[model samples]
Target: MARIRLTLLVREDWRDRYPAVLERCRQAGLVIERELAAVGAIAGSIDEGQLLALEAIEGISAIEPERLNTGLE
Candidate 1:
């Protein structure tokens, strides 16, 4: 299975329920990278096949796959 990098947007003030969120992500087989707490986001990699499962996890607002972009403002 192809692994893709993804950024997961979560509910506001996500730390209050971080443990639940972490468990959910782990269950989705994601290799967690970093936590952006202030913005309620997480970075990680997971099999492409698991995309839908990840999205279905509670509290996830958006799933944005990594993309290529030149330095354009």
Candidate 2:
């Protein structure tokens, strides 16, 4: 299976919904690869169906790939 990475930007007001969203992700077989709380960013991989499920979450602003690794300057 090809792994696809996605970055989700969650709204501040929806912080309370994080747990539920995570549960949903798990139910859909999506694994959270990484998270950056400071930026409200979540990176994960999921199948096409799971991706569609995630899009249903209300506070999800944007979902895209973590395309760049800018670790060293």
State which candidate has the highest TM-score: 1
* Residue 61 lDDT, candidate 1, scale 0-100: 80
Q: Compute the lDDT for candidate 1.
A: 0.86
TM-scores of the candidates in the order shown:
0.83, 0.67
- Backbone atom clashes (below 3 Å) for every candidate: 0, 0
Model 1 RMSD to the real structure? 2.1
Which ranges of candidate 2 are over 4 A from the true structure?
A: 68-73
User: Per-residue lDDT tens digits of candidate 1, residues 1-73?
Assistant: 8999989888775667866887799898989998876678889999999888898898888889999688896
Clashing pairs in model 1, backbone N/Cα/C closer than 3 A? none
Candidate 2 colliding pairs: none
Q: Which ranges of candidate 1 are over 4 A from the true structure?
A: 13-15, 70-73
